[model samples]
Target: MLISMTSEPELQNGVGVQDSFQRLWTPHRMAYIKGENKPSGPEPTDGCPFCAIPAMTDEDGLILRRAEHAYAVLNLYPYNGGHLMAVPYRHVADYTELTAAETLDVAALTKQAMVALRTASGAHGFNIGLNQGSVAGAGIAAHLHQHVVPRWGGDTNFMPVIGHTRVLPQLLADTRKMLADAWPVD
Candidate 1:
């Protein structure tokens, strides 16, 4: 396995890391964050989907990898179409709350997820990140996990600049199949 390295500095203490994450991601959300607590996205209601994925044997919005401690699902509101998130089963809020084993397991699952996404989506590269704290842009700032998003050379362009719309080329289900076929054992 290859180790991931980030030259990005340790998140600055009071810099609204969440906003930075948001801006770096879908620029359309920039308006919502100008003076708001949350951006306009799918709000987790009742039972959080990440927590419920393991028990249910369904795949409506579920994209890929359903397991005991780890799972991958397509972001309903994604930066890119095949954007995937590897979340743990428990309902922990921040990264510091995760045990070393859970942290390691999450990382392993994330790497495999990136490989799976690449095989299925034909992405040239990726932007894998974690929104650690609510202050750090954790939309579900409640649950901690890493997002593995695929990117192509000219994926982001004029619309996001002039129209404020973010476009993705493929259906999430197709992206799911590509991923499932690539990493079915998990």
Candidate 2:
């Protein structure tokens, strides 16, 4: 939908100078850049999505699987396709605060996520961990969650490094279905 006014050396609308590079428009990322949906406070009632998602339906929440104390859900802003998180239902901010049952459930779900991603997408490796706090890069620091990011050989390319954009081949809905189908049924 972006029409280039490159016929002239410079754009009259103050757009930009004409360049030989092609454009890849990812307007959806603007919401993230603008900090949309970010929680205003540290409480679950303060619009924390991790606390809210468990109450929604699986498809609506992009949830892959649910355990007794935790659940596995797809990341809304994924670092890679099939990127997911295992979150404890309790609104605990720190990992050390997790109950024994919650800890076991979260670990189980994270393992299930890895299995599902590998089965569905043939992921070569994984990046799995928790961002302890906002300072440690937790977007939603009010809740505790463990990330499960699938990785493949040569998945990193110049696009993310130079353009600061990640190219995801499949829609989030499709990925959710695929991983859900591949989830280990207990």
Candidate 3:
């Protein structure tokens, strides 16, 4: 049987299969998929993103706040709308390596991030934790950072499960602006 190019074909079950989905061609995501932004080596000077981000301007790095020994920056690849990470400047791989000062600063920054995210996005809740090593799902295992993921009701949906795509409603820069503006002064 000859099939017409203009119309969708019928399946063996006699149901018409229409080509409905419009492709959201995210070419920029190719770099992430190919691991382009990942660090070249274990050393901080060897292209560690967490280590390098603090050196850049706040807008350039999507940084929300900076403390003495630690800082908070928006996640480049966010699982949710307002995902952020609190990281130490020293580029220590393990949490145990943090000095008392670094530990306190990181914790303070994380609390500040939560308040910023809440004020910026009005998020209902959050997921805060750390993935220690590559085996534990740390994408950048050479640096230690605490993830602060904002959550909303029904944010989990079929798109991620069925299409393997996350539907982010806002741009990263815009999200950064909102969080930055909402960040506490102290």
Best candidate (score: lDDT): 2
Which consecutive 10 residues in model 2 have the weakest lDDT in total?
Answer: 1-10
- The total of clashing pairs for model 2 equals 0
Model 3 misplaced regions, further than 4 Å: 1-22
Ranking by lDDT: 2, 3, 1
Per-prediction TM-score to the true structure, in the order listed? 0.69, 0.92, 0.87
Residue 25 in candidate 2, Cα distance off native in Å: 1.0
State the lDDT of candidate 2 residue by residue for 36-87, as single tens digits: 8788999889998998898899999999898999999999999999999999
Between candidates 2 and 3, name the one with more favorable lDDT: 2
Per-model lDDT:
0.67, 0.89, 0.86
**Which of 1 and 2 is ahead in lDDT?**
2
In angstroms, the error of model 3 at 156 is: 0.5
